[model samples]
Target chain A: MTYLLLFLAFLRVGFFSFGGGLAALPLIEREIVDTYRWLSKPEFLELLALSQLTPGPIAINAATFTGFKVGGMLGAFVATGAFCLPSVLLTLLVVTFLSRFRENPYVAGFLRGLRPALLALLLRVALSVIQDGIHDWFGLLLSITGGALLFFGKIEEIPLLLLGGILGLLWYGWR
Target chain B: MPERHRHTFLLFLTFLKIGAFTWGGGYAMIPLIRRELVEKQKVLSEDAFLEALSIAQSLPGALAVNTASLVGLMIGGVTLQLAFVLATALPSFFSIVVLAFFFLRFRELPLIQAFFRGALAVVVSVIVLAVWQIGRKAAEDSVDLVLTVVLLGFLLVTGIHPLFVVLLGGGLGLFLRR
Candidate 1:
């Protein structure tokens, strides 16, 4: 039952989560935490933290982690596979069509209209991250400093990300 | 070189690099994509860059994957297009599978936890930087800024699903921007 639920839930996430993994969070939170009772709020939060820490999409990570907790290794496989399946199929279809209509003006115009909306969506997601991740003054300062360095200093991203982690350890460890 | 071959090779190389380094999902991929597509490939001009960014946002799947697919289609032929999508997605797929395979063992490592904490902080910073850059480019006027702020406020306050906001914003952009 849990495996089936995990597979179906994640399949929905895979299909409907149009923006990205971060955009998928509220929906996942609703399903996993609010609807399914698979994980509590704090556990969902931990899952998010873990997802952020690990590689891959957060939705996939959350699916795997929650599936494992609920069922086990099989759950993990089912969840991860279900989560990614839509993307694979959708991309294949899009590619197939694009191969033919690559020059169609209507397709181009639709994409043109879609662009601003995408920008708006990305901005919304970024703001949500700031809201959830930065919980205190130190965290806020870290975000600001990091943002400034990346924006104004034009520091390479790898180093900037590494610096944030180091600062997290120093600040959070001492506290 | 034939344009198709050039685009395909570029797509493969770009996504391979993104896959290798990007952790913590799509936001992390944004700057890298910007660096490569806009800065390196120069496939998209400033206006087109903005357009691609918009499309990637409104449409679905992973942002990195979506951006790669569109850019791939635009710059390269179908072969390059598929290569770019694969390149962007394959890294995350492998990484997650590995993590899942070693789930129990990996979960217990204190050092790993510490590393994650450090990396997460950095990821946040990287996201912030991305927002700042995107805002500078995307918000060209007061209307754009208002739309951004209103949407932000709506999300923060009402806890509405992002998809709805995105749809609403798209309608607003179409009606207002034009």
Candidate 2:
């Protein structure tokens, strides 16, 4: 029953999410926390963190996590399938038309407008991470330095993630 | 194998590799796809890759998934399209499940807690990086600059539903696109 419900819920997310995973932030939040009542606000934040740290698209990562929490492995598979199935079908149907109208002015305008909002929405998600991830003073410092490295140095991402995990091990393990 | 089977297998392998290895997600896949497919194998022409990327981004799904579908559309047909999309989605699906399994099971363990905490803190920084990169690209002009400020301010202050924000932005964009 919940499997079907999970599928139905993420189906909306799969279709409507524009821009990318971050673009889906508000929608995913509303679906999981506000509408379905599957996860609490705090639980959702943890999911977001996990989504960020894990590989893959952030939306898929979050959906899988939430589904696992709700209904275990089958739930994970169902939620992911439901979430992506619509977009796959929709893409097949629309690619022909989309290519034809790729540069339509209205579409361009629509994308232009969505851009800043997507960035702003990402900012909102970023804040949620700070809220929870900053467990102590050292954690804040680690976040600051990590931000510095990413923005200033432009280090490739895989290493940066590894560094963060290693830093965590050192910071928390010894202390 | 038949020509059709060969194309499908190629699409699957390529998209599977992209999905499994590409980090930073979405836009990050753009360069990798260009390098791996466009430059190396010549599976897709540069123009086709760009066209597909634009179409993918303009549509609703994740860029990586959408791009793979578009690529599949070009290389084979509907059947191969499904194959590509699934291949792209598969890696993330399995990995997160394993991570979630452990995360849920041993969340109470102090050692694991410490590691996740550190990793998550860095994840926060990654979010900020995403914000900067995306914002820098989008907010290229004064109007966009104003839109960024207005939108970011509204999101931070009013806490309006983002659906309304996206809709309002699109509605306003129709007139304001300059």
Candidate 3:
């Protein structure tokens, strides 16, 4: 039953989550926190923190962690597989015929329309992450400083991520 | 023996490299993929690269995986599509398995916890920057700005599901954009 629920929950995410991992957050929060009562709001927030820290898609990390928390290793596998299945299948279907219509103007136009929407979705994701993840003044400051450095200074991302992790440990540990 | 077969095999190998090395997923893989395919392979043109980016963003699943599959399919066909998907996903799958095996034992270590904390801070910064970049590119006109503002407002104020917002945005794009 746990495996089934895990699969179904992530299957829904895979099928309907149009804008990738961050875009999947609200739905994930709803299902996990509100509907299933699997995790508390704070717990979900913590999971979000963990997800970001991990080395994978935030959504995937969330699913894995949630699944592990709920039903252990098997749950994690089920959730991850279900989350990915829809895309794997859809890609297969789409790619089968995409070549033929690669040059179609209508296809081009449809895609052209998608770009702005994608951007909008990503921006929404950014704001949502800030709201849920940044809990304190320190967090806000860290986020701003990190964001500014990346945006203006064009600092490479890996080092910034490493620095943020180190700072989190030092600040939180001392406090 | 067909050229298509060779292309598919090549797609598999290339994506395998992407999946193997990419640490953070989705956005992290973007630059690496851009460098490899656009710069080194020269498989996709600039316009196609932008189109792929747009499509990948609008689709479900991991953006890196989705983008890789799209590019592979475009260049090498159905076989390549399967290969790319597998290639992009394999690393995460294996890594998660490894982490799960050890997480219970190590989840409580103070130093490890501290490292994760620091990493989380960096993640926050990375996300903010990504949002800013995407916003700059997406907000082209007054209509685009309005749509973005409205969407952001809805996300913050109302608890409407994101999927609905994305659908609505797509419809708005189709109807409103010239």
Candidate 4:
């Protein structure tokens, strides 16, 4: 029963999480944190950061991690499989039947409409992450400087995360 | 190994390597896919890859997973698609499980908490930048701008589930002909 719920929950995440990994944040937060109470908000944010810091897709990471927490190794596999199932099924559907789907005007219109709304969703998430994630002056400074660097330069994500980790150790470890 | 089996195994290995090595997420895998599949192995032409990317983008689910599935389907069919999905997802599945194990165990440690805080701070910045970059391309016109604001207000003010909000957005789009 627990496994089934996990499957259903993540399946919803897979089907509804359009756009990509970042766009999936609010939905994931809803199902996993608010709906299921599987992970707290702080833990969810940590999962998000960890997913970004590591390799592969964020959705997959979230599924596996949360699944492991809820049910164990088997749960992890179940959740992860549920998350990937949509892409596999949808990919097959598009390839076999709807090759011209993207070129369709109505489809284009729907996507164009979906785009800005998605932007709004993403913006709301960004604001909340900032609100929940930043607690100290150092954190604010780090966010501002890091965001500036990312916007201005070609800097990659891992290195910045690594630098942040080191700065954290220096600042918080001693104190 | 038989020739066919070897070929399938090699294809699986290619995706496994791509999955394990690439950081950031699905978008990050594109260059590697282009390099390995398009340029190196000659699995598919550039145009085909682009088309696959478009199709992948159009679909729901992870962009990386969707693209990999399409490429796999193009190369071999359902068999390769299944294999590709497994290969692509396995690395992160294993990596995160291990991380989660350690994270749960040592999460209360001061050092871990500090690192978590620090890392999360940077993640906040990354997300802010993503909003900026994606927001620019997302709003194509004044109508879109208004829609964004309206949707955001609904999301923030109302207690409506985001799933419903997403549906409402799509429903509005179909009618608006945006």
Candidate 5:
């Protein structure tokens, strides 16, 4: 039953996760955190941090870790397998009839429209994260500094994550 | 060794290297895809690579995984396609399992909690940046801009399922075509 739920939850994540990357985050959060209550919000954020810090795709990392935490090794494999299943099937379908979808305007139009909705979804998720993570003056300051470093200074994300950890240790650990 | 065996072995090794090495995931693997698949292996022509990329982008699921699957299919067949997916995902799978084991174990420590608080703040910043990046591309014109605003508001107000949002976006897009 647990394995089935893991598969179903991640399968939904895989199917609706168009444009990939961070765009898929909102849906993953919905299914895992909201629907199943598998991982709490803070835990989800921590998962996000780990996913960013680690190698490989964020979706795959999320699936593997969530499954492992929720079930076990087999659960991890099952969830990851479920997540990849849609992409395999869909890609095969697309490859087999490559010519038909090559210049399909309907597909293009749908994708174009998808971008805005995806942006909205991402924004909603961001807002919630801000609400959850930024609870005090230091939290606010950290986010601002992190934002500036990421956008203006053009530093990479992994370094920023590390820097944040060290700063947190100093700021919160001591106090 | 037989030619087919050699081809399969090369395919497996190339994808494994890609999955294991690339950091930051998703589109981060594109350069390696170009380097190994196109430049070194000479399996896919530049045009074919781009085609696979576009298709991967269009379809749902992880861009990295989709691209790997397409490339695998192009080179071999369904068997290679499945093999490539496993090869691409295995490294991350094993690493994350190990990491999760540790993370969950030490999650209650105050020091670790402090570290996560800070790290999560950065994670929030990353998501905001993602929103900004996608926003620029998504809101291409007045109609798209309105669609974004309206859909954002709708999501905020109703808290409807994201699947519906995607379907609604695609449907509206078909009719709202300029």
Candidate 6:
């Protein structure tokens, strides 16, 4: 029953979590943390940390972590599997339908129309994540520095991540 | 292996590689997929890839996984598409599981905590970059700019579920473009 609930929980994440993993957070928070109580908010934040460090999509990683905590190894596998299952099926369906109706107004309209709204949705995600992470003055300054370096400075990503980890170690570890 | 089997195998391998290397998420994976599938593999041209990307971006789910599903369907059929999805999901699936196993056990170590705190900050910056890139392109002209602001206000104020926000956007899209 737990596994079934886990599958269904992640199924909703797969079906409706547009944009990406960050965008999926609010919904996942609502479903798993609030509704099911599978994990506490603090535990969820830890999973968020894990999701970021681990490669691949954030949503999938979170699912695996929660699944493991709730139902053990099998729960982890089932939750991760169930998370992606819907999207895979839906992707195929949409691709097939779109190809055959490439010129259809509705399809074209949907694409043309979704732009502004999607932008806002993504913005909401960006703002939310930034709001969550930047707590102290140093954290705020770090994010500003990170954002500036990434966008304006044109620094490469790997080194930036390394520098960030070092800064965090020096900052948090020392304090 | 049969020719079909070989193609499917190669497709799976290609996605496996993409899934393994990508750090930021679906949007970050887009360029990598473009390089391999469009530039090298020549399974899809740049234009077709972009078009599929457009559709994939709007749809719910991970864009990388969705894009793979689209590409796999075009190259082969349902079976090939599903194979690609599984291949794509597998690397992240297994890697996260392994990492979580270790992370949970050793999380209390000061070094681990420091590293995560730092790594996570950078990770968020990567996300900010992704959002900025899209916002630049998406927020063209006054209509788009206004819609973005209005919707931002609406979501933040109303506290509506994002699922509904997205669906409402779909409807708004039809009207805005008209």
DockQ values, each candidate: 0.30, 0.60, 0.43, 0.78, 0.78, 0.57
Q: Which regions of candidate 6 are displaced past 4 Å?
A: A20-22, A37-49, A100-102, B38-51
Model 3 scores a TM of 0.76
- What is each predicted model's overall lDDT from 0 to 1? 0.63, 0.77, 0.69, 0.87, 0.87, 0.75
Q: How many backbone clashes does every candidate have?
A: 6, 0, 4, 0, 0, 1
lDDT tens string, model 1, B1-178?
9976775676688778886687757677777877887888787676655655565554555666666666666565556666876676556555655665565467446654444455455556665565566557666677666766777677668877555665666566455544
Q: Is candidate 4 or candidate 6 better by TM-score?
A: 4
What TM-score does candidate 1 get on C-alpha atoms? 0.61
Q: Which ten residues in a row have the lowest lDDT in candidate 4 chain B?
A: B159-168
Which model, 1 or 5, shows the larger lDDT? 5
| Winner of 2 and 5 under lDDT | 5
CAPRI category for model 1? acceptable
Better of 2 and 4 by TM-score: 4
| Model 6: how far residue B170 lies from native, Å | 1.7
TM-score of 5: 0.97
> How well does candidate 3 score on lDDT at residue A139?
73
What tens digits encode model 5's per-residue C-alpha lDDT throughout A1-175?
A: 9999999988988999998857678888898899889899988889989998888999999999999999989989999999999999999998887645846788777877787788788888889999998777888898998998899867888999999888888899997
- Write the number of the candidate with greater lDDT, choosing between 5 and 6: 5
Which pairs clash in the backbone of model 1?
A: A18-B60, A115-B54, A115-B55, A118-B57, A118-B58, A165-B118
iRMSD of prediction 3: 3.5
**Tens-place lDDT digits, model 4, residues A1-175:** 9999999988888887778877777888888888889999899888988898779998899999999999999999999999999999999999999999877877877776787678878888888899999999999998888888888885778888888878888888889
